[model samples]
Structure formats: structure tokens, C-alpha cells
Target: MKSCYLTRPGLLCALGADTDTVAEALFAGQQQGLVLEQGWLAHDHNAAVRVGRVAATLPILPPAWQARASRNNRLLLAAVQQIMQEVERCKQRYPAHRIGVVLGTSTSGVDHAEWALEAHAAQGQLPEGFQFEQIDLGDPARFLADWLELTGPAYCISTACTSGSKALVSARNLVQSGMCDAVITGGVDTLCRLTLNGFTALESTTSELTNPLSLNRAGINIGEGAAVFILSAEPGAVQLLGAGESSDAYHISAPEPEGLGASAAMQAALRDAGLDETSIGYLNLHATATIKNDAMESKAVDRVFPHGVPVSGTKGMTGHALGAAGALEAAFCYLSLTDTQGRLPPHCWDGVADPALPALPLVQVGQQWRPGPRYAMSNSFAFGGNNLSLILGGGA
Candidate 1:
């Protein structure tokens, strides 16, 4: 099968939109997560939790784009615009027909649905001029394709939190199958009361900032962001390397204990990359800070990388962006690979250590590391034990 390579990638997250800004913040050990302001959490008394929220509101898009008011759509549009601008710079290499767009989002436009319903309750009718397409699950992908004039296949992946990572897999397949010469794959998720209150109802909303793998760790704080990457068949680019996915079917909202399925996903990714576990120099763990999730992840990592490999979770900086988490973190990995010095920001393990969590070498300080790693892996496990892992590395 033909290989897929990542050419250009970008991110818009809580830390900052541009790559330099976000990278600087990460390397500086500057924390972006903060306690929710009282104004934003007017009614929720449990707003003390620190959230990784973008300091700036999404900018206004063209008038044509504004017709779609869904928060998810807005973020998707922003990411797509940024990605297209990059593509335009290298337009000769990736033409229109050769390009594709594949995105992931769990809540698509549900925020708009909630707003429509609320407006109807007060005005006795659905909000005027509200287009149903704006709230459709495929709207983000379709709108992006149209906006970029991309004629290749367009798709949307919605497998809960694994959505973004799954989209990358889909984009890789499309290129390997010769369906498109180049593809843009990533995820976008925006803040909404539905997710906030829903997690709160499940008692998964952490009271304090999340402490992944910490014995005192609480739950997870929901966050919003978007990330996108350009993939092609050309050489010299950061290769996708390989991807693995599995489903345990244990529960709708919990991972299987012992991480049976999560372990399989990691092992499969390594097998696809044709490398042993020891070859993986660093890992971006799916440390959401939730008890079950963190425990299961720790077990999986221990099973795979027992040599004290460097591992860290950026969720401490970006919170949990759900569907967008995988893609955003993947962007971080890509940056780590291509930056002047191959280095990644340390995972903020601020609180006391947790004895129950497995012992893995966690990168806890921001510093430059020389000699780029040959391989790196990213893990994304979602509800129902839907697990996905991707192994990426410097060009062969």
C-alpha cells in the first residue's frame, strides 16, 4: 500500500492559534488552563475547575460563512481557512482535485440545536432563518470542502473522542487508495452548555484542575479547539507511519478494565509501523484525568512501553477538547518532530504523585532536546472502548 505523509500542519487551541505562540507557551511551561470566571459560569456552582480555554474568541468569518452559527462549525471554518492559506502557499504541489478534507466532531452542531430549541421556547417558533444544514453532522466537512474548493472526497468522522484520530486514519486511507493525492485531516470542537452540563450530570466534571495519573486526580475539564494537517504522498514529509484502531464494546461511556482494547490498539500501531515498543521514543498519552480513563491508560502504557520512555499528556494545557483532542495533540507531535530542535513541552504533573498509577518517565520540564527521535506515538481512547493509536516519525 502507498504511504501517506504529513506535509503541513496547524493548530488553534487554548494556548494560542499560531504554531510559534503555542510552541513557545508549551516550552515556557506556561499553563493555559485556568479557573472558570464567575461570569461564564453564572449558574454552575462547580465552576472552580480549571479549564484550558482559548483566550480569544473565534474571529468572524465571511458573511457567507456566518450563516452557519454552530460553535463547532465556526471552529472548523477557522481551522479550514488557516489550512487552506498554507495550502495556497504551496499550491503547485497540491492542486484542487488532488486535495481532500476529512474532519471529526462528536457534537457537530448540537449547540445550535439547543439554541434553536431555546429560541422556540421563548419566541413560540424556531429561530428565524435557521438552516438545518448548519446543525447537520456533515455540515462542517461539506462547508470546508466548498470553502477551499476541494474536489476530492469529503468525509466526517464522529466516533466520540476518537473522532479526530479516526479522521486522520480515513484521510490516510484515501491517499493510500489513490482516491486523493493530498488530504486535510483533523478535528474541531467548541464549548457548549450541553457538554458541560452533561458531563456534570455524570459527575465527571472535576472540581479542581485535572491531575492525570495523580492519586489526587479528580475528573476532566471540557475544552474547545481545532487542529488540521495536510497529508500527501510526497517524500521528506513527516510520515503517518501507521495507525491502529479497536473496539471493546464493553460499555458506552467507559473503557474496559486492564485496557484490553487500548493495549491492542497500541500494539497494532507498532506492528503497522514495523517497529518494536522500544523504538517509540516518546508518547502523547490520552490522559483525561478521569479515574477510570487515566488508570486504564496507565496500564496500557505500562504494557507497551516499560523502558521508562518519556510520556506526557497535553490535556493539562488544553483540557479535554473531546473529538478535537487527538488531532490537536497530533499537531503537537508534528511540531515536535519538525521544530529546529526536536523537543516537546513537559506534561504538568504539578500535584502529588499517585502510587496507583504505573511508573513511566514523564517529561516534566520544558527544554530543548537534540537529535530528533526516530518514532513517536499518540493514543486516543474514547467512550465504549473505541481506541485508536497513530505512530509517526521523522522521514526515513
Candidate 2:
């Protein structure tokens, strides 16, 4: 495969509305964005749950794009707006058809549908603005393609939590296969009753702050946000060094307990990057704070990095963004690569560590990576034993 670079990035998440604000908040270990809120449950009687949300006001879609209006697209728009200039530059450098849009999303616009359904149950008709296209899984990509007037390949990947990471992988393939000169990639997802209620039914949520790798760790706090990256043949400061994916299909909703599949993904990424395990300086763990996820990930990480590498689970501050979590965490790694201070995202959790799991070197608030070539690995594992690992290298 040819070298594929991540030229520019735009991010909106619980950490902050843009990449700079988010990078500052992430390095400081700020948890103010994660808050306990109510009104997400199926029944009004359910208690409030902690969730990471974007407090910033998102831009509204223009009247011309009303058919694709929804909170989900609004988040994606906020991110894309940050890089609009760069995206336009790409259009000038390459033909419109050579620029593609590929994104990942789990709840495209279902929140809007949920509200429309409520009104239908009581009013006997769908709301005036309600459109069936709002809830389509492919709406995000379609909306971007239309908004940017790009005729290249545009699509969405919806493989549970691996959606975002898989989108990045697909974008790289497009560039390497000579199908596109540049690709708009990453993912976006918004908080909604449907997503929260689904996790609640699966017993994968907690009322308190998420605590990863802690003895008293309970469950994950849901979050909403989006991260957008411009990938192309253009040389840039940061590059997508390697990508690996695996699916064990061990169970419908549980990871392979021993992490056999997870380890395979990491190993494959290392091989793809043409670097050994020791080359990685920091690792962004897929720490959802769930017992099974943490346990399985711990074993998988240990198997891949026996000598141990600095690792931290960022969900303590950003909450799992479901399908968008992969891109969100990758944004964290990208921020770290650009930081001159060599700062790493700290592990936020109780002081107590689980004795049953292997001991891993969790990052501290002021900890920094060694001075040299900076390579960070991020892992994302989803339902059905689907797993992905991405390696980002730069800031040498």
C-alpha cells in the first residue's frame, strides 16, 4: 500500500468544540464535560445517567438541505466547518470527482425520527418536517456529498463501534487503489434516547462517572460527538501508519474473553506499519469501563505489548461515542502527536486497580512520551467481536 497521510482534522466532542480546545482539555484531564443528565431513558422513572455531550451550539443546516436536517448532521457539520478551507483547497488541487466523502455513524438522524414518532402517536400524523431520509444510516455521507458537490465515492460504514475506524481504513484504501485523490473521513454520532435506551437494556450503562480499570468499575457513560479527517496523498505532519481489523464473531454482544481476536488485530497493525511493538510510545485503550470490555482489552493489550507500553482509557472524560468512539479516540492520538510538550492523555479512574487483570502502565496527568519518533496506537472493539487498531505516526 502507498503512504496515506492524515493532512487535516476537525473535531467536536465532550472535550471541546474544536481540535485546539479539545487538545487543551484532554491534556489537563478535564472531566467537567461529563455530566449526569436525565430524560434519556425509555421510562421517565429511570434515574439520570452520566454522559459526555457537546455543550457548544452547533450550526444549523441551510434551508436547501432541510431534507437532511438533524442533530447528528449538525455535529458533523460543526467538524467539517473547521476544515472547510482545507477541503476547498482540495477541490482546487484535484477534480471534484476525485474528492470523496466516507463517514461512519450509528444514529444518523434517529433522534429526529424518535421525536416525529412521539408526535405521531399523539397527533395521528407525522410532523410536517419529518422525512424518512433523516433516519437513513447513509444520510451522513449523502449529506456531505451533496453539500460539497462531490461526485466521488461516498458511503457510510455501520459496523457497531468499529464504524469510525473502519471508515478511516476504507478511506486509505480508496486513495491507495487510485480511486480518489483525497477523501473526507471519520465519524459523527449524537446522543439520543434510542442509543441510551439500547445500552440500558443491554446493561451497559452506569449512573456514576465511568471508571475504567478500577476495582469498582461499573459501566460506561454514553457520549456524543464527531471527528473529521482529510486523508490524501499529500504529505503532511501526521500520517496513518497502519490499520488492522478482525472479527471473531464469538458472540453477539460480548468480546472473546481471552482477547484472541483483539490481539490479532493489534499484531496485524504492527505488521502493516512495518514497526515492532516497541515502536509505539502510547496507546489509547478502548476502555468502555464495562467489566467484560476492560477485562478482554487488558488481556489483548498485554499479549501484544508484553514489555508493556504507556496506556490510558480516555472514555473517563469523553464517554463512549458508540460508532463514533473510534474516530473520537483517534482524534485524541492525533492531538497528542501534534503537541510539542509530548503530553499524553491521563488515565482517569479510582486509585484502586483490579488485581485480576495484568498490571499496565497507566498514564499520569503530566506524563509525556519519550523524545523521539512519536507513534501512537488506538484500539476499538465492538459487538460481535469486531476489533480495529490504527497507528498514527509523526512529530518526530
Q: Residue by residue across 1-396, what tens digits does model 1's lDDT show?
A: 887788656677777876677777776556655446432343665456556776656657677666776777777766666666767754566777778889988778877887888799899999876778877777788877887777778878888899999999999889888888888789988777677777777778775777778888888878888888887777755889989899999999988979889999999999998988988877899998888988888888998877767888888778889989999888877877766756666787565777887877788675444454567799999988799999988832
Q: Candidate 1 — worst ten consecutive residues by lDDT sum? A: 33-42
lDDT of 2 by residue, 126-229 (tens): 98978999899999999998888999999999988999999999999999999999999999999999889889898999988899999899998999999999
TM-score of each: 0.93, 0.99
| Residue-level error in angstroms, candidate 1, position 226 | 0.6
lDDT of every predicted structure (CA atoms): 0.79, 0.92
Clashing pairs in 1: none
- At residue 81, candidate 1 shows an lDDT of 65
Model 1 misplaced stretches (Cα beyond 4 Å)? 38-49, 89-95, 367-372
Which residue runs of candidate 2 sit more than 4 Å off their true CA positions? none
lDDT of 1 at 383: 84
Per-candidate clash tally = 0, 0
